[model samples]
Target: MTMIVRDFRPADAEAVAAARRSAFPYLVTTAETVTWEVAGAPAERQYRLLVAEVDGQVVGSSEIGVFHESEEPGLAFANTSVRTDTLGRGVGSALVTAAEEWLAGLGAAKIFAWTVEAPHAVTFAERRGYRRGRSSRVQRLDLTTAALPPLDPHGLPDGVELRTAADFLNDPRPLYEADVECTEDEPDDVPAGRLPYDQWITLTWEHPSLDRELTTVAVVDGTVAAYSVAHTDGRGSYWSGMTGTLRAFRGRGLAKLAKNDALHRARAAGCREAFTGNDGDNQPMLAINKWFGYEPAVTEWRYVRELAA
Candidate 1:
């Protein structure tokens, strides 16, 4: 029963992705995304992807890194997932130990992680000195049979227009600006700061999973008012990475408008299922998701551990 934990290699992408999907099926994971994450991380973040092997077979994986873009310093994260068939073999514990050591060596003051809300999963973290915190729910919509809201582009407000991300291929600064505003206001445990345009371009705008044609934006007076970021695994499944409205556009129902349009586009593009995650306390977004016929698929509990300074 020899178990080993080591840094991820490009050749291990498929196996690592498979382990992740086994733990969280609602997520959009692929070999390309796995490889991109390790290669595209910002140097300041000190990111690393670790894989756990048992008897020469990859059975678990985790990503650990500093929260460089967060307003709060010394914050870091480690998310570990083990293949269900190999869970009791110490694979998870090995990965967690390796990740925590790596982050601590990098001078992180705290580490945040999450697990599906199950008794065994909860106990695993608690035993490792992690305390439970907030929870988020992953919702799923059956795109094949959902009663989606009809989109009437002509019926929009006088200054409003519906457009896709592809419409801004020449210059996406407007979308990036709107995203910065929308993201800052979202409820989260980590206080995320705006990413530089160049980092955003490489890490987000050009992500392998992002589907520009399926992402919808609400334009008001030539400016992006709201938008729905769409990501797909190219396997008939779509994920709403984010759906938000700018401060001035909150009450205008623009977020819903953008999200609905994105969903429609995703379905029309042959996707059969849609998924999204919302913080437990984000009632406004939760309500909107419910309106879209998204039902709770699973709840994930956040956990945190403090390291000695």
Candidate 2:
């Protein structure tokens, strides 16, 4: 069957969402998130969310655009996915090829994408001239029966405290600072230094999916030291957005404390499953998450192809 590439329409939201769910079950997704992403993309992003339809059924999608968050220019991405049951019918290739042609036309000089660590995905990327880069390891926690570590008083030094993100309602700048510090130090080939507060407010704070009250923060001597920002589908699925400790406050188990607090709150709020991603090289965070009873779910690899000539 010939796969026909076309731009997704408003009516195709449900099918696109189903395709995404089939492709990436680990994520907390919905038709609304898919629709919101395409409709609300900023002008500079030059984003295009396309779908591949075969026999009048949407079987694949490609979210292609420049990484607007990055400081560099001409660096674009085309992450394509085919529905689990639809992979061998040329749908995936057609969607990817269409996205590539669109991005190349948009003057994208370098394309970066992420594919699951499955052999077929890795092989497909390599054949298309993409070289492997950084990776994100997805971890899953069985929240229902997790025997969580007790919050030890002695584990934290004196003058330290833990709080939820709600405490920062009046002033979230401290949380913002902590985020900037940790994000700067995060292990990534794409280095985003000193993320601005305005962008943080728009991109992180104002995201439609965040569950601020479930998000936890660690404070030491009246200062924000660490935090775990939580995102939920408002149903049951939960995801950890940013979990890190400030540079001045390492070796204190603050990262674990913050994330644990968030996880506890998440379960209390009726979320039975939790998900988080860590860089392949981040042994410290990996150890921390494993302590929380999170096991490996899948590995996703970032791939890059230089269009710079």
Candidate 3:
């Protein structure tokens, strides 16, 4: 049967989400979040979502776009995923070809993609001229089975307080500021460029997957010092979107405090599974996850190819 690759339609949201979930089960994904991404993507991103159909059945999907926020010009990405059952049917190649053509048309000089560390997936990327780059590990915790570290509020600094993201619904600028500062220091192959407050509010703060009530924040002397952003699928699965402490608060264990509080709250809320990812070389963050009893689940490698200008 012939495979057809075309732009994703609104009606394909559910199929696309399902394909992504099958390919990357460690990450949180839903139809609502997929729709929001396509509809609200920044203009500069030039985002395009495409799907590969076989005999009228959607079996693969890809999200391709320039990294608009990157300080470096011409950096782009095309992440593709094929349903596990549909592998070896050419869907993966077709999706990647379509995405590469779309991104190259946008004057992209380099295109990056991620693939699970499985041999077949890595071989597929290698055969496409993509070179391996940095890697990250996905960790999972059985919230229902594992004993979470005890939270000792008394151990917090004298002027420190723990709060939820929902508490700042009326005023999230402080959280935004804290996010910007911590993001700047995150380990990444590509620079983590500055994100404006307005965009943060729209993309991160208002995202459908975010669970404001379960996200914990650490405040020191009335200043936002650290936070753990939580995302839940409302189906017993939870993800730590991000956990970081402001530069001034680093080494004080505030990040641990915030994440511990958030995780405790998540388990209490009946979330059975928890997931998070960290750069392979991010020792501090990896140590923190280890302390929380999260077990390594999967590893993914970033691959990049130069696009002829």
- Structure candidate 3, residue pairs in collision: none
Judge candidate 1 at residue 291 and give its lDDT.
94
* Residue-level lDDT tens digits of model 3 in 65-161: 9888999999999999999999988899989998998888889999999899998899999999999999999999999998887988457778999
Clashing pairs in 2: none
Give Cα distance to truth, residue 243, candidate 3, Å. Answer: 0.4
The sequence of per-residue lDDT tens digits that candidate 1 reaches over residues 1-309 is 888899998889999999999999999999999999999999998999999988888888999999999999999999999998887778888899989988899888899998999887999999999998899999999999999989874698889999999999999999999888878877888988888999999888989999999999999999899999999998898999999999988899999999999999999999999999999999999999999999999999999999973
How does candidate 1 fare on TM-score?
0.97
RMSD of each: 1.2, 2.1, 1.2
Alpha carbon deviation, residue 24, candidate 2 (Å): 1.4
For model 2 the TM-score comes to: 0.92
Query: What's each prediction's clash count?
Result: 0, 0, 0
TM-score of 3: 0.97
lDDT of each: 0.92, 0.86, 0.91
Better of 2 and 3 by TM-score: 3
Score residue 181 of candidate 1 by CA lDDT.
Answer: 85
TM-scores of the models, in the given order? 0.97, 0.92, 0.97
